[model samples]
Target: MNDTTWTTPDLTGHRVLVPGGTGAVGEGVVRAFLEAGAEVIVPTRSEERSAEFRTMLGHAADEHLHLVVHDYTSFAGAQDLVEQIVHFRGGLDSVVAPIGGWWQGSTLAEITEQDWHSAFTVLGTTHMAVLRAALPYLTDAGAYTVIVGDSSAWPVPGSGLVSMEQAALLMMQRVAAAETGSSRRVFSLVLGPVTTRHAEGFVEAKDVGTVTVAISAGPVPSASIGLHDHGEVQTALSLLTAGEAR
Candidate 1:
């Protein structure tokens, strides 16, 4: 595990889409890409959310940031959302989904039906939908990344449901990577406790974004990466960036 923060990638001229760019973690990822010179397309659930994201970005939310009102929960919805982006901007070079929620304080036996429904329906199914819908547009050379929480590895007692959904998403990306061949890549950024207004922790949102941007830019050796595993991430990014330079 490394204590140092990951560096951002040079995404000059790249076109990227972040599904939930208004949220804390999502905002960091979006900012990193924007600073890296990528034109980012963000999809929000409503005009209000789009405006909120714009306010969040402040001065950086100009020209390069394109916000669309869309839902990503259903396969059909994700498909339509992607179609809209493609129609408007031609296509995307990368797509990153930070769309997930966490809840604790209940054992599996004590978990309610609504809890189970929300966990699987939103966290599990929505990720699958994103993957299915992005495939058509994310052909050769494109990258798809999903941000995963620490509960996937370090399962908590009251957060069993969170662990379950996170684990599922982790495997989802791994499977996508294995089946993808060399055309496109599927990756996961396994995160620890992040420092967000929504949650209290160690990892900073900007640091999280740096890692996300680094991986999304390319040359990752495997499908899933631990944010705390600095050696691996840095080595891969260094090698890849160096190769690009030469």
Candidate 2:
């Protein structure tokens, strides 16, 4: 987290779509792809949000980066996004969804109906929509990667609802991998406390960016990369991408 410098992967000719690419962590993913020489398309709910994202990118914003106004949370919205990507980028080589929000409330037993609805509908449903809509357009060696948190791997007392849905998304990754076969890859990156505009702690946004770039660039060694220990993500990725078994 201290070092601001990291190596980016080579992704020339790669076309990527990042839904919700305006958020703190999502921006990292977007920057990584652009720096890695990939054509990146990001979707935002409004033109204002897209403009804000462009501002954040500063010099990194170029013709390779596109900001589209579309909500990827609904089936129709995701379909529209896929259509846009196909028509614009000529189809996608990969999709990385750093899409999810952190919420805290009562314990599992005390969790209200609203809690369940909000967590599942937002985190679960949106991921399902994005993956379902993008699968057909993914290249033979393309990938669908989701950024997740530690709650999915370990119990987090009052964060039961978030943990449960995250775990479900982990399983969903496995299911997608199975259904898609070896033609496409589905994976998840589990991180420790990540610093973002929403929250701040151990991991920096650039660290997320570095790890994302390495993984998305190609031939991931594993389906799940756990950074809960807060290790040097890029180093691990180097080892993995060098053909080391996970």
Query: What TM value does model 1 have?
Result: 0.88
Error of 1 at 103 (Å): 1.0
Off by over 4 Å in 1: 1-9, 139-141, 229-246
What TM-score does candidate 2 get on C-alpha atoms? 0.90
Could you report the Cα RMSD, in angstroms, for every candidate shown? 3.5, 2.4
Residue-wise C-alpha lDDT for candidate 1, range 86-121, written one tens digit per residue: 777777678888888878768999988998888766
Question: Candidate 2, residues 23-74: lDDT per residue as tens digits?
Answer: 8888878887888888888888889888888987999998889888877788
Positional deviation of 80 in candidate 2, in angstroms?
1.8
Q: Each prediction's Cα lDDT score? A: 0.76, 0.79
Task: Choose the strongest candidate by TM-score.
Answer: 2
Model 1: lDDT to the true structure: 0.76
Score residue 245 of candidate 1 by CA lDDT: 15
**What's each prediction's clash count?**
0, 0
Error of 1 at 181 (Å): 1.5
